[model samples]
Target: MRTREFLLQELHDLSQGIQGPFPYDDLRKMRETKRLTSHFKMLGDDDQLSADLNTYFMAIHGLASRLLTGNAEDAPTTAIHWLARGDFFAIFPMYCFLEDEWEQFPQFAHMYGSTKKMQEIVLSLLLTEDEL
Candidate 1:
């Protein structure tokens, strides 16, 4: 796993890079198949920053799906991937918000219970940040 400083620097570098009308078709396909490893592998380590951005994209997609559908099933499996990927560097806020709304998602109560430690880590991360 990357350090927080390294991940933050990568996010900053990605923010400075050329903005794209990026090709989403391949990514969308990979997402549908739940082939996240394949998707990340396609983005070689030479492009680590893009890989990081892709993880954030997945997290946002997860959050948006949950908010729109009000169903935990609608949440991206990638949410777990992002949680495992650097102690919730980019996905912390979304996870925290989702936890707050978890009461509306009784089906996910057991799963959420398993994630309590991650949620705590996310809270700590958020508290440590100068601004969220």
Candidate 2:
């Protein structure tokens, strides 16, 4: 099993993309994301959300495997492949806040200077169908 350090490094790589900046030491985010991995693992793969989560987890796991085995291969997945899947990095603030226990997403614009698309994504995740 991959350790917490490996998981955190994956998240850091995802958020930073092309190695923009070394992520700050955020142990809380690491723990929360680990918990999320466990929770998402229980869901059926048929669900879209479940599938996306599985894809993401698998992508990171693959990257971790490559790193641990001294096989530093650069395949397309997550923020490392920023040119191909750049949106993942663009919307990374959501994960930052999710790690912070879900802040008022409406202020994502003010806080992170996020755009309409990002706001809608956050709203869709946070609000119910009736609210939308």
Candidate 3:
């Protein structure tokens, strides 16, 4: 498994190019998001940090994938709908970590490592604009 700091670095690198909403609609079609949510559900209590990292990566990877779209009607907006379910509550994992008093994300500490950062690195897939 990658270290926590490595995942943080990945997220920091990811947030650099995002200017608006995350592309989670594309993520709804990605294998990675499915894997992320599945792994999230299977986590044990001791793996809260792992869960946090997974959520961050899920969102960031999605955003990075959409950076080149060059069009809006192509992907007008984004949402967290894929992770929300009637069967469960879907808190962004970093906020949940903070509520548990877990340390804030080192790379995102300026926002106390929450909220705005969540908006920064939201989810989509690797598909190019032409593919979408």
Best by TM-score: 3
Distance (Å) between predicted and true CA of 7, model 2?
Answer: 10
Cα lDDT of model 3 overall? 0.38
- Cα error, residue 23 of model 3, in Å, equals 23
120 Cα displacement, candidate 3 (Å): 6.0
Question: Cα RMSD (Å) between model 2 and the true structure?
Answer: 15.6
True lDDT of residue 54, candidate 3: 53
lDDT of 3 at 99: 41
Q: Name the best candidate (by lDDT).
A: 1
Off by over 4 Å in 1: 1-45, 73-81, 84-132
Q: What lDDT tens digits, residue by residue, belong to model 2 across residues 7-83?
A: 44543444343222212223234334655555434533532432333344345445544544545345343433432
lDDT of 1 by residue, 66-102 (tens): 4334454444444544454443333444233233333
Off by over 4 Å in 2: 1-47, 74-79, 82-132
lDDT of 3 at 2: 50
The CA lDDT of each predicted structure is 0.40, 0.37, 0.38
TM-score per model over all chains: 0.26, 0.29, 0.31
Off by over 4 Å in 3: 1-14, 17-48, 71-79, 83-97, 100-132
